[model samples]
Target: MRILRTWECKIDKEIEKCKQQLNILSGVSTNRTTVLKIINDVKKHKDKALAKYSKLYDKAFLSPKDFRVKDNEIEEAYRKISLPFVKSIQRAITNIWTYQEHIRISKVSPLKTGGIVLDTLYSPLESVGVYVPGGAASYPSTVLMNAIPARAAGVNKIIMTTPPSKDGAIPPERLVAAKEAGIREIYKVGGAQAVAALAFGTETIPKVDKIVGPGNVFVTLAKKEIFGYAGIDMLAGPSEVLIIADDHANPSFVASDLLSQAEHAPGISMLVTFSELLVEQVTSELNRQITKLKRYADTKRCLKKFGVIILAKNIDECVEISNKLAPEHLQIMTQNPRALLCNIKHAGAIFLGSYTPVALGDYIAGPSHVLPTSGTARFSSGLSVNDFLKRSSVITYSRSALKTAYNDLAEISGAEGLDAHTRSVQIRLNSRSGF
Candidate 1:
């Protein structure tokens, strides 16, 4: 909604302000207290706490018996949804499953170095919990993105947890997607309570080895809280997109992309471009497009508070600024989008050219849209089959191999004053015939 100079100090402050607004850590003390209480209650009381919060927060009024999604409900879901929607979900499931399988880890052959054999074994997690966020909205895409990868990784069980609508029913779209993704065990619960229920086994909802997906502030905070107890994918914050455009880029396209991100309500949208004329055009287009959105007020507020167009000196400066932010979604709308690829290193996902919008990555694209946010792309990556697999290092040493390294091992253990470690090795060689 405003123009910022690349050299201006206000750039940092403005970005920090919006980040604080978008980050889960920026939540008030009450949120943490609430999340902790819900976690504690769910751990101690189990299904009771789940039911209590389901009634209090989601107003679903589900009981312990109603927590698990029954077969009848899934059958009803098929009846409720349209044929086109089912076909679309089926196609998306195939695409996601194929992509995840392609990138999934494979068996590593043992490395035989003399008498030593070293190998790495990759095994899928026994069970995984997929958290699909719902309160104001339902995310069927989230179901596919989170669950399909686990299935492709050969995980034995994939459980799903999502908030229910006021009518105490999960959305037919989400249910159908879950079925296609091979997630049979689903519970009608969400928010912090849903996360807690997944972390600690309730009477009905079983605990899982790891939890994956995105959610609101409460759910994100709950994931942060239960990280040690139950593995989490990432501490994802609100959605964000950064677009770099040149004068040749279409103003309408740029504005539409920015608006798409802003429609997430608290989403942050930014543009780094050298062309002031394009800025003017995009801003005008934004104003014109703002009136057509269903979520007009929320999107307008997000754009007003968090959106900005930065006037960079050139393409290099644009890339430099983008790397610093490490935005969740980076779109290059320059003449040659791939030309900027080498200079750009930090981004959750990168989309090249004007035709590639962020929504493709969000919904139908093969890659999982569950990406790192809040500058985390510098260190982490998007969710995939890799997250569901655990690796174990296997080592088998022959007698000759152990004897060859015995002296060094003994000396190192001696230096550490661990006599027991040296003795354990020494005992093996004490009565050898050569000795």
Candidate 2:
């Protein structure tokens, strides 16, 4: 694997060396005030800090009556796995519930004017909590990408959790992908005291308004310190890709899409190109396909420290250093990747050609492999059904529409000091004269 100064690189020092190489994806190497004092002693001794951090980090011995996971152990984990991994988790939960059942969003106009009326309402978010990471293994594809978009946004109580090995069980293909995403509330609990028992609630879990997946970094700093007491799905980092190749791409399909996101362990796998002979034929096909990789030491330290093979002096300077390294899987492989995808602004998922890798958008290309890493796809997205719905705004007014905006609503509620919102609109226009 060659580096040769990424072929005289200098596009603002390769975008300040990919933002100082994402300071090793700033996460998971513990000690944040000793994991926030064991997640504030599992949020003030809940189930005795989840059976003493499940016997000091999954060496097992959990109790509180073995913390949920029954129903004949989800029919004995669907009769002990493999029926082609249970029909590949029933074809990836029917392609992520038919691609998040087309991210619904309705409730529109109830509009009128003089006798005013307006609208908005969509609801659906009773309970959410989904975690699914079993350390160094078992994801069951993050339980079909966070319970198939909270069961296509009609949520109503999905609850799940992981981490229980060392001998305490819980990973039979993560309860057969949470019982094929219908999620029969399984729990065992993982780090940061399973995100403080799904953000504080303990008699045996059940306090969740929102909490999706992907963890480590003490469960993403205990979901960034219990985000406003709940609701969280982003702040996730570590896991990236950039690709952008040319010179007719493939050196064994760009070394298997840079070791399939560098075995997603301390991951970040760049390869921006303008071809120094296809970066020495994709660095000798990533040293002969990384000796038939099996997470070859975490894909060789993620291709030797946040990999790179950059050359770029064309292909629009490798799409301007992949829009300043906005990679969370941005593959492109040119020669008209849909005419450079109208100058891709930033990417959380792009995968245009070379048989569209990025592992087919990480399992049968529906759209979400829970994206937006470090550069936060230059804003944020991925994980939809608009993140399990919630919207409300509707109004109605009459009395000749408050006497046609009574003095511009008392001059904008007396210019913001809000004098009881301008004497309740001048006591309903001076006791109803509608003036």
Q: Which candidate should be chosen as best, given lDDT against the real structure?
A: 1
Q: Summarize candidate 1's per-residue lDDT along 213-285 as a digit string, tens digits.
A: 9988889999999998899999998899999999999999999999999999888899999999999999999
lDDT of every predicted structure (CA atoms):
0.90, 0.79
29-126, model 2: which lDDT tens digit per residue?
45666667877887788887898888888888888778787789778877888789888778878887887786567667687767888888888789
Q: Candidate 1: where is the Cα deviation over 4 Å? A: 8-22, 431-435
Question: After superposition, which runs of candidate 2 have C-alpha atoms over 4 Å from their true positions?
Answer: 1-62, 65-112, 119-127, 135-160, 168-203, 207-211, 214-242, 247-257, 260-280, 283-285, 288-294, 297-328, 332-369, 372-381, 384-389, 397-435
Candidate 1 TM-score, C-alpha based: 0.96
- Score residue 167 of candidate 1 by CA lDDT: 82
Q: Worst lDDT window (10 residues) for model 1?
A: 14-23
Clashing pairs in 1: none
Native-referenced Cα lDDT, model 2: 0.79
